[model samples]
Target chain A: MQTVAHAVIAAAGLGSRLGLGRPKCLVEVAGKPILEYQFDLLAQVPDVRLVVGYMEHEVIDTAFQLRRDITIVRNPAFRTTTTQQSYWLGGLHIEEPCLYLDGDIIFERRTFQTFLSCAEANAPLIGITEAKTEQAVFVAAEPDPRTGFLAVTGFSRTDRSLWEWANIACLPAGLLKENGGDVFTRLSRHLPLRAQPVECFEVDTEADLELAKAYVTRLHGAGTQVAAA
Target chain B: MKPNTAFCFDLDGTVTRREVLPIIAAELGLAEEIGFLTQMTIKGQIPFEMSFRLRCRLLAEIDVATVAKIVEQVPVDPAIAAFLGEHREQCFLVTGNLDVWIARLAARLGCRVFSSTAVVRSDGRLGPLTSVLRKSTPIRELRGQYDRVVVIGEGQNDMPMFEEADIGVAYGGVHAPAREVIENSEYVVAKGETLCRLLLTL
Candidate 1:
């Protein structure tokens, strides 16, 4: 399995849905800031680059103290743009099969273990969840009855789907050359959804943040279990 | 004017002995809050300028007399100080430290200083202006203003300015950066005097 050297965490949006005065990434979900947990996870994997905006100093300072190995980049346009712009602004720092983690996510350790297992398998992986209660993004996955390769396909149109996008993706890092936008932007145009059952989760609202905190705590207490897809 | 080259020099580590705010915060008993913010800024959890301004505002609550007394304990890099004195017009002290220190530093070095300033009330309570002046924008603006622009510093805050400068020197005498800034800089000089003595050729 080829190793990934640079994991890029995009943290440049005012998560208005969270209703916090600070950026969603800066909001403390448990004892740790949501972004800090993500950084801790990335520190376990490989070296990383973080793209930050909004209250950037708080983000940068917190991250640096956590892991000095990270490469900090800025996206000052966070106020008026989307995560796609933030990720694209940090494209130059991408190298290897970069794991792109949304800064506002909280999940089980098994979720990451499963993703890592799938990631090392050389197939481009996007962390997806089985627990879909809200308006979550997901991919349709069913055995192709004939050729036997999993058929993963779904976009914004397929609201009622089997699996939801956990807001985390793993790309070859060079895919940006093929399409100039983010993973979703390029995948929406180029590839169909390929599903892997990893319980990755996204935290959008304050309720979601609380849920994530509890879920992650439970997952940690139970220990990791990597599901074979 | 021969297309004045704007030389942006970071105050702490680059121009001074140590990180000024962190030191002052330690002195004023706000080290815990300030330290947390400092860690966040370096970690990419927060912006450098904002954290810096926040620290300044926190420190400004103390009297100017006390601050000046505390600042007296602050040490300037003699080599860089002399270098700026010799090339006064071209060099600019670009720091996130407050205006009081900026003015004091500029006067001491005989160069212009561009930094954030806090509003001190008659009752001596300090309040931050909160307008973010990014260190990166100033470097770009200076680059446009001058035939050449150079930046010197150590730490993640200096990454953008270092990336844009015609001559980027990371003075890592106090705290050496992990690897990113070390690799990005054109020159890495740890000794303050060694870097100053070498700057004559450039």
Candidate 2:
């Protein structure tokens, strides 16, 4: 399987709805901060650029503690701009194909492994899951007639039948460079989007955090049971 | 001077609250040496052209990618954004820093930049300095076009510009303007907001 060596994590949002008084990535989940798990999984990726705002100093401190060579980009106008802008800013330093992850996401390492191991190495791949939530980015997909692989038709905010976007994707450097004001919207139209099934969720509110914790705990318990059996 | 004046700003201390070269040097673990050289140059103990070339030579082996990442994090004065927004076309970033290092920053500010140029090697590392900027050149160039050229700076490097400009403001927002810069200027402003108000009256 082909492996990418760069990743861009957009963690610049204020996370006001999370009500954490700090950036959501710093919020502890299970035993460690949410971004810690992400760093552990992405340790092999040599270049990791973290776009930070809101509590930038704290985030940079945490990120440096996790990895000494991590590159940090600050979006000073983060209060006025969207996550897309932060993504663009962080992507500036990355020159190779990269995995783009949202800061508020919590998922098993296998989810990323699955996406990386998938056969769609050349094209952009967006992770999608059967799991649904009130605040999920819905992705429309159809089975490819030739290869039986699921091909992404479009993305929407209010599509009930569509699977939820898992907030993780492997994007080509060219696509990242071409990103403008509305990145995701433009990307869906420009790239030949492929879908990878992964078990993942985004954390936005207190209830979402609880959901993430419970999901992780359940996965851990299931692993323990299998080990004992 | 009327509203049709050209505004030239010194990048390191005047426009940005921090000295960019020392920050870059500190990131590369050469802060003490570079910092001393920078202070000596600014204090007029060493000539700028000589200090600048020596600094670039020390930075020659550093990868352009690493420098770009570090430069991206260098903080700019917050009030300068609004000030530039109000007078976009007239604002110019005049810095002695290499073009290879400050390109992204200048592009982000969306202003014309008069900066030193560095030779980028085939391997993507910074090479020798091709051009050393003299601030007076840009100030004199602006004078030909505008009725009044208002220059704001805080370093001895800006002394030539202060002599060439029609109106000079010694800015001490980050630290006190150098003695020679302060002596040559007509007004001195220490705060960003106050500087903006002073510019309005110009």
Q: Which candidate gets the maximum lDDT versus the true structure?
A: 2
Docking band of candidate 2: incorrect
Lowest summed lDDT window (length 10), candidate 2 chain A = A220-229
Query: Which segments of candidate 1 are over 4 A away from where they belong?
Result: A120-123, A131-133, A144-149, A177-183, A220-229, B1-202
lDDT of 2 by residue, B16-120 (tens): 889899999999999988988988886778888999999988888899878977887889888886787678789998889999998888777888899999888
Residue-wise lDDT of candidate 1 within A1-229, one digit each (tens)?
4456557788877777877877777777546777777765665654466777777656766766766556555665567666666665555434457677778876555557556655643456666667453556556667656534455665553556766666676776555542244456566654554445556556787667777767766655666431111
Residue-level error in angstroms, candidate 1, position B12: 7.4
lDDT of 2 by residue, A1-229 (tens): 7777767788988888889899988888777788887887777776676778788767866876776556555676789887777777666534566788888887677656767777344678877886566677677787887655687787777776558777777877656542255456766875457778877768898888898788777877777311001
Question: Model 2: how far is B1 from its true place, Å?
Answer: 43
- TM, every model: 0.55, 0.54
Which regions of candidate 2 fall more than 4 Å away from where they truly are? A119-121, A177-182, A224-229, B1-202
Can you list each candidate's DockQ? 0.04, 0.03
TM-score (C-alpha) between model 2 and the true structure = 0.54
DockQ of model 1 vs. true complex: 0.04
